[model samples]
Target chain A: MLHRGRIQAQGEDLEESESWAADTPPTWQEGIAMIDKLENKIPKKEADLRREAFEKARSFVTQAGENGGVNAVVQKTIMVKDSKEARVDIEVRKGKAFI
Target chain B: MVQHLFKDFLKNKRIYAENVGYWQSIVSELFAPTQIKAEAYLQTTFANGEPFLDGNPIFHFVVKKLNKAVRIVQEVAESDKLEITAWISNTELDEMEINELVIVLQLSEESKTIALDLIRTWILNDETVKNTKLKIKEINLTEEILAH
Candidate 1:
């Protein structure tokens, strides 16, 4: 499957491991490092455009709220992975967290 | 810039939804799934006022109020009246803008430990300057997430 910048072994491009140095397991860390180096070489606009995509797909946030009748997000967060729609919510009843 | 996007969102959520693929590509560059972690425990600050885990904090706070016959889909739900500080980010092609805002979220609920745990991974984890490598650039919150 297509993941990150590289095609999986199943795709048209080379498998990630093969694309790397003859040695080494070719971890994601290497992928990121390679990206960092490549970023410097790309045009500013292109580099920035690339960065923006990653930022949007991944968001880290928390919310906390107290002194509420039922819903006060004192400190909490809502993360919806691999989707564009919103997916963070909580329902508390009398000091308890439940599904 | 973030505020401007917020206004735009208010005008049309489909604005971004309209061109999801294009928008996704832009945001894709800034984060990788590995960098995007979901583990909350009552605290979170993606960007320190200083970049990459600096003690200094720059927060994008926003507040949203409940509006017009609010409703949701859930078997059980309770709500609280909340005043909030929201933070958000918007990817406009080559430009990435982040901002902090303040708004009120009306119609909320009070929670206890047991129920809170149910949604812990999604919201209540704590990650900040002292913990993760995530930086605090700018935060732009949306009303859709806050509206009661």
Candidate 2:
């Protein structure tokens, strides 16, 4: 019978244990710290994107669609789709279900 | 002279009328892509609420927020009235396109509702419709914020 204690006693087990240590994700507290680091840069990034989006949206609404007249939007519907192929693929796979 | 004044009034009325309908459609659907299902995602994967904001797909290539998309999600959890502000644009590979997006939602409802408001704010702020009144009493979803 292969005893579990015998494996742990082996010198090779030391290397296996080291590898296991390397595989661990950050600790919960460390993870929170990582999240904080990632989050710190988020606002500025998103703000820039927001500004660009506003410009794009405004241009589309005015120059591209001016013929419809402002009142023309009454009948229009809003459908959001990613222009990037990768993003579109993600949406298609996820089917708009969050997570 | 009276005819000229009438024409001016009609033009103004037409602009406001058009905006009114656009706002209605916006509020009706409200937070779309981030439907009620988002709450589940937040609870499970995204820092319990801190999903970065910039990665949202409401904007395509010009803005990428993949690794940092949880900030906005976390902000909503921390507060009640936070604004997202993004664009919902679509074009035919730099050809024909449409970028009309208007949204209104009660931030205090759910994650989906909050996301809807944030993204909608960006769409609603389009310069073309910026001058129009944003409220009509016909269907007051929230207070009187409806775009007129």
Candidate 3:
């Protein structure tokens, strides 16, 4: 689901060893410290592009989810934001229900 | 001059009747939009407590432009009434979007009721809201206080 919020895992299914997230989510101070550390890694221009990509991805997900069901796979990668030709093809699992 | 006085009284009544008809037309003109039906998109997606799916079309218009989703969502969680609390989310929105939404919300008593129900359901059922501490507010839009 394309959700707008600080992304966080909800369930306990993620194994601590496999997951990059801290077992106990960081405090506000720690989160800020982490962002500060990673600030140099992300370019300012790329941030805008990334934000646009996220929004586009969200829209793609929403339309696909509604017309078909939840089961979908990311098919290809393209960089430009305005490509109407850029489509995320959805494979609807008709007989199987995920919920 | 009793006849003259009665004629003057009749003239005054005629003026009053004309003014009443004119004002009644004006009032109906003002309220005409409210009688029109809600947009089909809104009716299908949001009305009647229909499930607010992840990629609902409304999200494309409202939430996509949200520079202040966290703050707005938090305020909604704390609102005494969901729609009233949502009024503040307008601050984050451009004027055009707000105007469009206002028309929808004010269209009819039925639209307002449906919208309020949708807001209440959407907030309570939101997946990201794991914080049990965040209290669910009732439908009271009169008092305006920003919580958080």
Candidate 4:
């Protein structure tokens, strides 16, 4: 036992901690409210991109609906990529209604 | 004959279906770019559990139709990013007769806050869709609503 106690650790704990330290109890409701508030701030540019992608998807579905046949299952899938290169995929189909 | 029925179904329900799915998908795709997980649910319930009226079915066919539409939209949203997955569901609320749709998304700690803020803004600012309102509620990890 070579005087290990005399040689103490010197470096600080720098690794990122996964746990969050809060003084008070974290309520589920509060966490949800916080998330809601954050989502509401999505940039206008991003919103517009999403809207455009949605419209394109709608158009595809409409066209498929327009051309329908008996016992026919119309299926259409489309992919939209935004300026950031994020891709969105949409798939639609119609057939016998089920409960 | 079947084609005619579907055509009529789509024509009568087109605008509603389009608006509902479009708005939900737009939000889904936007968040997808950030590798956040997002999903939308379109549900219908009959008032007082009454039978389907001549004007509207007890369970309006549109809800299911829109679910499929949203699925397609999610598919497109995923092409841009590998971090998002979207799901849609239909639930029958006993003795209730109102059509309800909800879009719920899961994101990283950083992205979660951003998404919540955007939804709050939309709820306060956007009123173009008639009789539609946006609400944000928490999902308990232990009590998951995604399966439903």
TM-score of each: 0.18, 0.19, 0.20, 0.20
Chain B alone, TM-score, model 3: 0.18
Instruction: Evaluate model 1: give its TM-score.
Output: 0.18
Candidate 3 share of real interface contacts: 0.00
lDDT tens digits by residue: candidate 4, B1-148: 0011111223345643553454455555554555433333222221123211111111112223222222222111122112222222222222222233323222233223433343433332332223222222232221134333
Per-residue CA lDDT of model 2 for B1-148, tens digit only, reads 0011111222354643443344334444653544221111111112223311211221211112111111121111222332222223231111223332323222233324444444344433322333212321112333324222
Cα lDDT tens digits for candidate 1, A1-99:
111122111111211211222222223344344434544554554444445333321221111111111111112222222212222222111121110
Deviating ranges (above 4 Å) for candidate 2: A1-99, B1-55, B58-76, B84-94, B100-148
lDDT of each: 0.23, 0.24, 0.25, 0.27
lDDT of 2 at B15: 41
Q: Model 3: DockQ against the native? A: 0.02
Candidate 1's displacement at residue B135, Å, is: 5.3
Off by over 4 Å in 1: A1-99, B1-3, B19-23, B32-148
Best by lDDT: 4
Q: Give residue A81's lDDT in candidate 4 (0 to 100).
A: 39
